[model samples]
Target: MALRIVSADERLSAAGAKTTMAIFGPSGVGKTSLLKSLPPAETLCIDLEAGMKSVQDWPGDSIPVRTFADALDIGCLVGGVNPSADPSGFFSEAHYQHLRESYPDLVQMIAGKRIIFVDSITDLTRQAMAWAKTRPEAFSDKTGKPDTRGAYGLLAREVIGLLKHLQHAQAKTVIFVGILERVTDEFNRTTWQPQMEGGKAGRELPGIVDQVITMSLFARDGDGWRHEPERGEDRRLVCRAGNPWGLPAKDRSGRLDVTEPPDLGALLSKINATRKG
Candidate 1:
């Protein structure tokens, strides 16, 4: 196969560089409210959790993802198909054609949007698991009984494949907003993670995206501790990895401070800024 080397000129054009990020926070942390901070004209939200009440007044478009099938179709619509995938495999060109036939205007619906927003992966995982339970893989061949382990395996493969497909949408930015959960172990040490049904997707998601941000309410003193907002404190987006607090975050662009204002548009602008001399 002949391959042409990409030019440095193309590399420096940040406008063409696509970004995939996951922003996680606890419930009622205004994760959905971040939608208003993005440019409405260039953003489209895939509302999987029915959590648009917070952004109801925002002048942006969103598609309600009520079922697992809708989620898959939308993913395929936005990400396109994997050309190298097996013809009969999931999310192959054959599946793409089926989606096109079903939703003929899907492309036109999101043609002008530069950013594809997913409201919450926590609920998406629930939907995916629900669908996985009905499939043959979720049943044990020996007993023909339901097997949660098999279901989770299928869920992991489907969700990860779907995420990778979205990551390959190289011309548009993709953002997945998810709920963050706090867990304490035997040592009573608290750790944070994305709240999803299956463990595999949450664990592997950080490596798949360009950025892993934690949107949380923190102390104004930069102490890396959560503070009550009722005390008139502020919330910040934790962008960089390795901090006193165990919030999960990473900045691949290397252009962000440890904490940044909770605004999506400004965050994206900073990430896409070109290097200086």
Candidate 2:
């Protein structure tokens, strides 16, 4: 194979490609509710967490994923209607083959849309971990239990693989919702971060997406409690666009407000405007 080189102009032209954003926060922080505001006609949500109850009143298209197989089948369009293999046995060769075959279809599906959202990457990680535990290869014969180290390694690979697939899809934008996890450092200070099941995925996640936003609650003096992005008198959900208070975040577009209401459409519009300028 010969080395290929691209011109600076070509590279700069591709720099304006669409973005993928990851949003994470504590439960009840309105992560799911934020999706309701996205343009329903242009967005499709894969509800892996089955937490659409928050957006039940919102008119949009969503698919609830019950099992790991169900999630893969929906996202990748493989493994038929009902998979006979145990969900925990996802590491099997057959499952890998199915994943390989379905990737092209997944790319096609994402290419046909402007926005593809996955509700709760944390829950997806949980599903992957659960599957890893059931794999006999990850179990310790001496203890008759799954080996923690082995299981976590498998979980990380599975979660990262799926995330990589979504990241590389042809959709104009991709959004991953996740829960927040509180971690205590050596200084005894607790900081919130994305709740990725395996430590590896949590570390790798921020590098894959163009943005990492944290949805949080804010209190305004005597206003009791309100969302971080609330601008009016009433409390509403909001997002922290860039890194704040040790939270992992990035605003590649550099046009988003540090704290703004959770509106995907507005975010995209601002990015597009910036690109045009």
Candidate 3:
């Protein structure tokens, strides 16, 4: 229960190279396609959906794919997937012990990354739900959002904490990908249309890291010249500064330059130099 420091100075210089983010949007918005654009060095992503295989020429194999249980399976990993009502968080102590016995090397391997991308946080959140189901039949809260002591919430907290810890201790850049959840709009004030929101965990992310980039899309830019483009009017990734589902970027200030061809090595170089400086 000790407080862990997450300063850029404290994090490994390798991991402190770039900002952490959450790329989120409605389905078919090309989230998977865009990640292929990032250079693995400046931005390595942990494949949760395993869709990295679809993209050719991306050295995605550089990033490791792991589940919350995968981390808990190893030692020195205190928090991650736990018991919950959702099927994903439904891990048991036996499963944890099994991971320790079976995949002991998982933590060491994961701890050695520059950028840690948790692709498709939707699945990650579901995994938390799974852990909730495994808790002993005690202190029930069907609300699905358990208190920190409750089963579901506890597991969710652990997973979130473990991720934050990875950022602080390992110095890996963290990117959590998820679908945007829509909530009633209270800010627009102009007709108050329904707005999009991130997953349940997104609500509390501001408390942990330095920055959270939300990759969101509004409307398809007329195929946007599938092959290439000549200007800002033709980018694919809808990126915002703080939260993916927060609001649309006003201009080119905080948007993903998806039009910037998918050159992994180049993007990574930029990220690393920034870290070195």
Candidate 4:
């Protein structure tokens, strides 16, 4: 086949299209609840951290991924079991090829959904690292530890690859839930970042997602410092959509408020409106 050239206008348009979002927050900060509030008919939740306990009453469909195998099952990538049965064997070349081939099926399953939520990526990375540690090639008996560099490298690649696949999938929205972690840089200033493992994934994830939001609480004076809110109460869940107070955030739509209600559906509407204008 001869090579063909196409103009920018011929390329796929991002405006008014599905968004890729990464939302991070402390435990019990309403991250899962906010996602559950989106249109249930068009949403599918992939629960990795048992986060559905709070939103158990939500009407949307949810798939609980207690193990990496469960995640693979959802993608229909569970090929023949490794004879050696090594936990890390799933990442072997043959198995990886199976995953690549079956990935389109997973995308097809999500094609009609407007939102595909993965809650949370932090746990997914943990599972990835744990799987890496089981690989003899990636761990050293002499050191009595996994090869930190190689293990995390594998994790970074696996995570980034899966996210990129979902990002380009037919789903209109893909949301990755994560936990918040505090770190101190050389400047001795404390900052918050997503609790995902591997330094590379931490640095790269924000760039891939259309929005990176940090969930927080908004309380009136004298309110106790509690992360969880009471049911039927008005304690607000705050979403910071941009860089502020050293929190990692970005909003490509340019319509999100510095702090707003933690309702993703409303935010998506605003983004669509802005893009149309």
Number of clashing residue pairs in every model?
0, 0, 26, 1
- Please, what are the lDDT tens digits per residue for candidate 4 over residues 39-131? 998888988988788888888877778765666444333222333334555434466456657666554545556778889999988887887
Among these predictions, the greatest TM-score belongs to 1
For residues 5-60, could you state the per-residue lDDT of candidate 1 as single tens digits? 87888776644467999999888988899988999988999999888998889898
Point out the higher-scoring one by TM-score: 1 or 2: 1
Q: Compute each candidate's TM-score over C-alphas.
A: 0.94, 0.74, 0.56, 0.74
lDDT per residue for candidate 3 within 34-145, as digits (tens), equals 6565555444455655666556566654433354555434312323334432443324445545555665665455545555666666766565556655655324467644
The local lDDT score (0 to 100) that residue 263 gets in candidate 1 is: 94
- Of models 3 and 4, which has the larger lDDT? 4
In order, candidate lDDTs are: 0.87, 0.68, 0.47, 0.69
TM-score of 2: 0.74
Per-residue lDDT, model 3, residue 9, is: 52
lDDT of 4: 0.69
- Give per-residue CA lDDT, model 2, range 237-275, as digits (tens): 333333445555677767776566667777766765634
Model 3 error, position 62 (Å): 7.1
